[model samples]
Target chain A: MEKIKSIIEVKNLNKSFGSNHVLRDFSMEVVPGESLVILGKSGSGKSVLIKCIINLIVPDSGEIYVLGQNIRELDQDQMDKLRAEVGFLFQSNALYDSMTVRQNLEFPLRRHWTKEMRDLNAQSAVKEALEDVGLGHTIDMMPAELSGGMRKRIALARTLILKPKVILYDEPTTGLDPITAREISELMLQVQEKYKASSIIISHDMNCIRMTSDRVIMLIDGRNYISDTYENLQNVPDPKVREFFD
Target chain B: MIHLIKIDSEFLREVGEIARFTGRFFSEVIKPKQEWEEFINQCFWIGFKTLTLVGITAFIMGLVMTIQSRPTLLEFGAVSMLPAMVSVSLVREIAPVITALICAGKIGSGIGAELGSMRVTEQIDAMEVSGTNPFKYLVVSRVLASTLMVPLLSSLAIAISLYGGYLGVNIRGNVSWHLYWLQSFGALGYGDFIPSLIKTFFFGFAIGIVGCYKGYNSKKGTEGVGRSATSAVIVASLVVFIIDLIAVQVTDLLGLT
Candidate 1:
C-alpha cells in the first residue's frame, strides 16, 4: 500500500456540556483524498466531533490540526481563512433562503476572493459549480423553490465552489427519501472523484455509508470505538459493532 | 424586601450575558469595516416596512389624546389649550414612547422570530462555519438600523399624531388646519423635544440588542424560537419603560423639564 498523508487529525478531543460530557477523549484522523464517515446513533456526539474539527463548538480540552495549523493556536482571522478551505455542508441544506442559487454560490467568492478576482471569474465559477451538480439551469431559482434533493445538490455545489480540500457532511442523507438518499450518496462519490477532496461525513445512513465511505469510525460513548473498512467492520463479532450492522 | 435586595442568579446571568453580547457587538462592528448593502437592506426591512402600522397608530393616538383632553379643558375654561397640550405630550413623551412600544412589538418580535428561525435552521451556524461573520452581517446591521431608524419613525409618528390632534380639535370646535399646525409647533420647545428624541435612541438600542440576544442565544428546536420571539418583545418593551423612567429623571436633573 502507498503511504497516505493524514490531512486532518484529532487527539484526545474532550468536549462536555455541563456534566453531559458529549465528547470525551475522542480521537480520529482522515487521510488525504479519502471519504471517512463517522457513524453513530443520534446524539452519539458525531456532530460535536465534526463541529470541533471546524472549531465551531470548541472542545473542552483537546487538540485539532486541520490542513496543517493547530486550530486552537490560529486566531479568528486564520480560523476564518482556514474555514474557506474546509467546506461544511449542513443537514438542513442551510441554503440562504433569501438568495437564489447563483447568489448562494457567489456568496463565498465575495468573502474569500478579492473584488478583481471575483469580477473576472465569479460568473463562470458559479456556473461551473452548478453544472457539476447537474443543476446549472436552477441557478436563478430561489432555495425555497427547489425540492429537497435539488437544494441538497445546490448546497453541495456551493460547498464545491470553494474547492475545499476538506468537506464535512453532517447527516447529508438524513431527511431524504430512499431514492434521493441514493442520488446524494452517488453525488458524494462523484464529488470525491471529481474534486479529490477529503471528507468526514457524520451520518448513520447505511446506504450512504456503503456508497461513499472509504473508511468508517463508529463514534460510541463519546469515543472512537472502532475504525475499519465497511466490509471488515460488518463481519466483526463484537456486539457493539455488530449492533449497528444488525 | 430582603428577597428583592438579594440578586437572583438567573437575573445576574442574563445581565452578564447581555453585557458580554454588547461587548461583542461593539468589537465586531468596527471592522473589517464593511456591510453597507446588508445595512441598507436591514434599514428597509426594519424601518420602511414598518411605516403603515406606526402611522396609523400615531394618528389614532393623537386624535384620542385631543378628544380626551377637551372636556377636562372645557371644565377649566382652557379649551383653546387642547392643540398645545396634545402636541406637547405627543412630541415630548407620548409619540416616542408609544412608537417605540409599537416597534418593540413589531420589529423586536420580527427580529427575534427571523433570527430564531435562522439559528434553529443552522443558517447562522452555516454562516459562521462558512467563514462569514453572522454578527456583522446580522446583529450589527439590525442594531444600527434600529438605533437610527426608530427615532425617525418616532418623529414621523409624532407629526401624523399632531395632525390627528388637529382633526380632533376640529371635531368639537373650529380650529383651522393652518392654525392647528401653528399651535402644534408653538407648544414644543427644546426642553420638550430634545429629551424625547434622545431617549428613543436608547429605546431603539435596547430593542435591537435584546431581540438579537434572545434569538442568537436561543436553544434548539421550534419551541425555542417561539420563546425567543416572546421573550424579545417582553424584554424590549420592559426596557423601553425603564429607559423612559430614567430619561425623565435625567431630564429633571438636567433641568430640561
Candidate 2:
C-alpha cells in the first residue's frame, strides 16, 4: 500500500470498566483512503477501540484524533459535527428495527443534513447506497423483514448515506454465511474504492481481513499486534495470532 | 437460627440494592443532553398508551370511593358532604398518586426491560459505535419524557377520576354534574392539588431514572433483563409512595392543608 496522510491518530489509549481494564496503552494510525482491518478475539477490545475513536465510549485517558479532530477535547456539538463525517456499521446491523430501510437510511441524514438539501435527494442518496449494496429494491422493507445478509447490506447502505470520510465496521460479517460474508467484504472494498473513504473494519473473519485490508493489524491482549500485510501476520508467533487464522 | 439469619440478610441486601439504584437515578437527573425523544416516547407510552386504562381506573376508583365513603358519611348524617369529600380525595390525593403508581408499573418495567435487552444484545454499543450519543439519545430522552409526560397524564387521570366520582354520586343521589364539579373544586384548593401534582413529577422522575439505570447497567444476559425490569417497577412504585408521604408531611407542615 502506498503511504498517505494520516486520517485517524490514536495515542496511548487506556480504558477500564471499574477495574477490568479493556484497552491498555493501545495506539494506531489510519491513513486517508486506507482500508485497515482490525483482527481480534471477542474480548480483545476491538469494538472498544473503534468506539473510543468514534466518541461512543470515551477513554478514561488518551488522545484520539479522527480526521484531524481530537475527540476527547471536542465538545458535544463538535462531536456531533465529527460524527457526520464518520459512518459506522454496527455489529448487529442496529437498523432501528421499527423503521423501514428507507427510514433507517434517512435518520442520520435527516438529523445532520441541512434543510436546503432536498429531502428527495436524501432519499436518492439512500437509494444509491442501497443500490451500491445490492438492496435497492428492499428499501421499503423493515429490518425485521429482511434476511441476515440483507440486513447487513441495508446497514452498510445506511452508513454510506452520510458520505462519511471515515467509515468504521464493527464485526461487519460475524453472522453472515460464507457466500454472504464474501459478498459483504467485496462490497466494503467497492465502498472504499468508489468513495475513496478511509475504512477501519473490525472483524475476526480471516477471509474478510485478507479480502478487504490494504493494511491489517491484530488487537491482542490490550495491545495491537501491528502488521502491515496479511502475508506478514502469519509470521506472528503469538498463539492467539496463529489461532486467529486457524 | 442461622438459616433464618441468612434469609434476612438476603432480603436486606435486596432492599439495599433498590435504594442504591433509586439514589443513582436522582444523581443522574441533572446531567445534560437528556434524551428528549426517549422521554417523549416514554410519556407517549406511559401516559398516552395508558389513557383508557387510567380513565377507567380513575372512574372506578372514584365510584368505589364515593360508594365506600357514602356509608360513613350517611352514618354521621353528612351524606350531603359526600360529593365534596370524594372530589377532594380523588383530585388532591388519590388520583395523581394512583395514576403514577399505575404508570410506574407500566412505563418503568417497559423501559427497564427494553434497555436491559439492548444492553445485553449490544444494540446500545451499536448506538455508541455509530457516533450516536446513547445517554443523550436513550437516557436523557426517556427521563425527560417521563418527567414532563407523567404530570400531564396525572392531570388527565384526576379529571377522569372526578367524573367517576360524579357518576358514583349520581348512582344514588341527584347531584348534578356542575354541582359535583363545583363542590369538588371548592373542597380542593391549591394546597391540596399542588402537593399531589408535584409528587407525580417525582414519581415520573423515579420511574424514568430507575428504569434507565437498571437497563443501562444490566448484567447476566437474558435473565438480567427480566430481573432489572421487575426490580425497576417494584422500586419505582415504592419510591412513588415514599415521595408521596414526604410531600404530604411537608405540605401539612406548611399548613397547605
State the DockQ of every prediction.
0.78, 0.33
Any runs in candidate 1 off by more than 4 Å, and if so which?
A1-4, B1-7
Which lDDT value does model 2 have at B230? 96
Error of 1 at B32 (Å): 3.7
* Candidate 2 residue-wise lDDT, A131-201, digit = tens: 89988889889888999999988888888888889899999999889999999999998998889999899
The sequence of per-residue lDDT tens digits that candidate 1 reaches over residues A1-246 is 644468799999999898898888988888899899999989989988998998889889998989877999999889999999999999898888788899899988877999999999999999999999999999899998999999999999999998999999999998899999999999999999999999999999998999999999999999999999999999999999988989
Candidate 2 accuracy as lDDT: 0.83
User: Which ten residues in a row are the worst by lDDT in model 1 chain B?
Assistant: B1-10
- Docking outcome class, model 2: acceptable
Best by TM-score: 1
